[model samples]
Target: MEHSTPYKIFLLWLLLSSLMLSGVFIVWDIGILRAILQQDITRISTIILFVFFGACVHCAWRSFYLARQALMLAYLQDELVKEGSAVQLLSLFPRGSCLAQEYLVGLYQGRDAQDKVLLSEIMAESLRGTHQVGWFIAGIVIKLGLLGTVVGFVLMLSSVSGLDKLDITDIKQLMQQMTQGMGVAMNTTLVGLISSMALGVQYLLLDRCADRLVVDGVNLGQAFMSVSFDERSGTL
Candidate 1:
């Protein structure tokens, strides 16, 4: 397999993130971003959106890191197949460098095929655990946006509490307050939905990349590495 196959998802992430950045610049250039900031008096919604963006970046980096590990695994698999020796495979890997080296070592140390299968699952989980926070933050982003909408409606309603009579001046003040509240509601909802969806796409890609890495590594191990199976075991 080409070494570059594992990194394709990461490259796509970079391209998509670049497009998002471009969109941000365009929004800023048009002054809409500035207007949203001014309208959101508490700035809470804006902060949430920024936090979501940071999470996306962090997850993307993690995915890229895993991709590199996959590439390393592929290289080691090629070497192991060529040399046909467990000792040679160990020599090819630097100390504590390869992601699945332990599993390979385990198989060579007399671990059975069943044990290898279990270890593969554990390794897959370990890699997947890194992205848990990113997924969680994605869900929180949407809820926070809805919270902002509620807060905005509260602000809009609060404008009429103390006034028993409506004078021209009081009515104008009320309208101004309502307008600000409405802006906050609309801005936050828009930001929240967009951020959540964008984050979702990135994470979905990362998930698929991780899965591919696990599958490729497992397949290589089954093909070239030594594994023992129980001859007495019966099929279901």
Candidate 2:
């Protein structure tokens, strides 16, 4: 836990910081900070929602490197599975494949049904961080968007409820407040849904990449599997 804690924290900070940076970039694109801040075109929650979208983008971007490595590893493993001995592939496991290395070594030893199941679990666990990080972050972005939606709804409701109390002079202020509330409501929901879709697509690709790696690995391990015909043991 202690060793892994830092990595998790880094990812957390990276997501948040990326969101903030992306927000800044978007704002800058519209105009400089001075102009964007003074403009009434965008709402605060809308900006935050876009920032969250940026965070989702960052997750997809980060997954690219891991997916590429996994794809390459799959290719190499498939080649080895076709013609080579398990012993010959030890040197070929990519970096950050400690758990996979252990699984391969175990494979070289033997792989009955029970062993295969155990190795499958190990493989999933090993690949989770690399292949699923984007998906996890995407989930977070979707939730954040929902949170924004709730907040927006609350603000809009509050403004609506107070409308009866406004006098003639306050009508203008009330209208402004209502508009802001509506902006928050509409923007948050739109950003959240859009971000989730993009993130889902991004992770879908990464998952296929992981699937290839797992398949190639399974094939590699099964290539060297031993079968027994002993009556006591049955066929294994």
Candidate 3:
């Protein structure tokens, strides 16, 4: 009867994300931020930062979305326990309550086969699709950082490629160019790594919530539903 609150995961994400953003702003205010931003001549580091912020926004939205679904699932469980019939379950939830409704409907319509295993597979596949984009974005951000590293190295090496006379002026220019190249490589790599790790953590939280949702959903099916077609037919 005592159900856990669904907002815990969402709230935790907000806290962790806020801390990270706060740290960035604190550093930004200290004046080193400009230098950091300016170091990446190719702007790869800046791009990575922007992309990371976008992913954070997405994770926040998704956390809220998943929490809402968890709440709906809880409500469905309460109603099912009381009414003892799944016939009205679909009507009870919103159209977006795909996980709950689909599971129940699948059970109702799958009377002939009544295969819980197959049904579970279908439900999991649906859930995975919802968060797959987040994973892809996580990976792309890291790759972009690596690309910046390569770009920086290329710039560094290209500066000395035309050296022939070994003049002091030429050497000075080459050294400056190499420093800029090193700056690009180091700054971008740092930005990319930090962004990837931060984004990865947010997605990790999302995955935990998702896993909980699946477990709770499966338990719900087992607790209130029967695999026997005849038994389920009358209830529906």
Candidate 4:
């Protein structure tokens, strides 16, 4: 199977993101999003939720691209088995350019079947680790947002309590404090909710992607082994 260059995939993603960001800015300028944000803490939270949702969408796209690459690599390995020449297989891949190509070269150079299998497993693990790190960062953003919301609530409540002790002569001052406190409190919650929701969705999508990769990798490995066995038997 022919595979498109990773650069092309990245460029596509960048273009998509730019378009999405432009839409977001339009909504912001039109006061639609601002009105929603002003409604209450919940609406603010919704905005936060969607931003992370966008991130998850991007991650899912990445996973799909990675899966395609893995399938291509498997197909290439199968071709190598048919050709029965590791050096010829190496020539088929782009020289010193793609990491996947390098990995295939390493696999082909392995001293034994077990060595090749080990290398494949190591490659899968490395990819999985990188994906997990992205999810971990998303989780951190969520937690920080939650913390901000909590702090905001505390301050808003404190302001309300202080207002209870003030007289009518302090009404203007009390109203100002109340509005400021409420705004701050709501802002934090909005940040937290948006961050948490977005990240949570991304985390889940990434997990699914990882699972799919593992399943596909195993299937590809089995196919490679079968092809190798057939070639060896033909020689005998």
TM-score between candidate 1 and the true structure:
0.87
lDDT of 1 by residue, 8-72 (tens): 66777888888987988998899987888778997866787788779877977876887777778
Order of candidates by TM-score, top first? 3, 1, 2, 4
Model 1 Cα RMSD, Å?
4.4
Model 2 CA deviation exceeding 4 Å by range: 1-84, 92-101, 129-133, 160-165, 226-236
Error of 3 at 32 (Å): 3.8
- Alpha-carbon RMSD, each predicted model: 4.4, 8.9, 2.8, 5.8
CA lDDT scores, all candidates in order: 0.75, 0.57, 0.78, 0.58
Best by lDDT: 3
TM-score per prediction, in order, is: 0.87, 0.63, 0.87, 0.61
Span of ten consecutive residues with least summed lDDT in model 2: 1-10
Instruction: Please estimate how well model 3 matches the true structure, expressed as its whole-model Cα lDDT.
Output: 0.78
lDDT of 4 by residue, 1-236 (tens): 32344434335445545665686689789996676566444343554556565665666566656655555565565665577544444466567533345555665456687887776676567556666666665766566556656655665676668666788888887666666556656565555655555555545655554455555555545554555456556752
Which residue pairs clash in candidate 3? none
Q: CA lDDT of 21 in candidate 1?
A: 79
Stretches of candidate 1 off by over 4 Å are 226-236
Query: Which segments of model 3 are wrong by more than 4 Å?
Result: 1-3, 112-114, 227-236
- Name every residue pair that clashes in candidate 4: 48-194, 49-194, 52-198, 53-198
Taking the tens digit of each residue's C-alpha lDDT, what string does model 2 give over 85-152?
Answer: 44555556654554445566676555377887788677866655554666666677667667766776
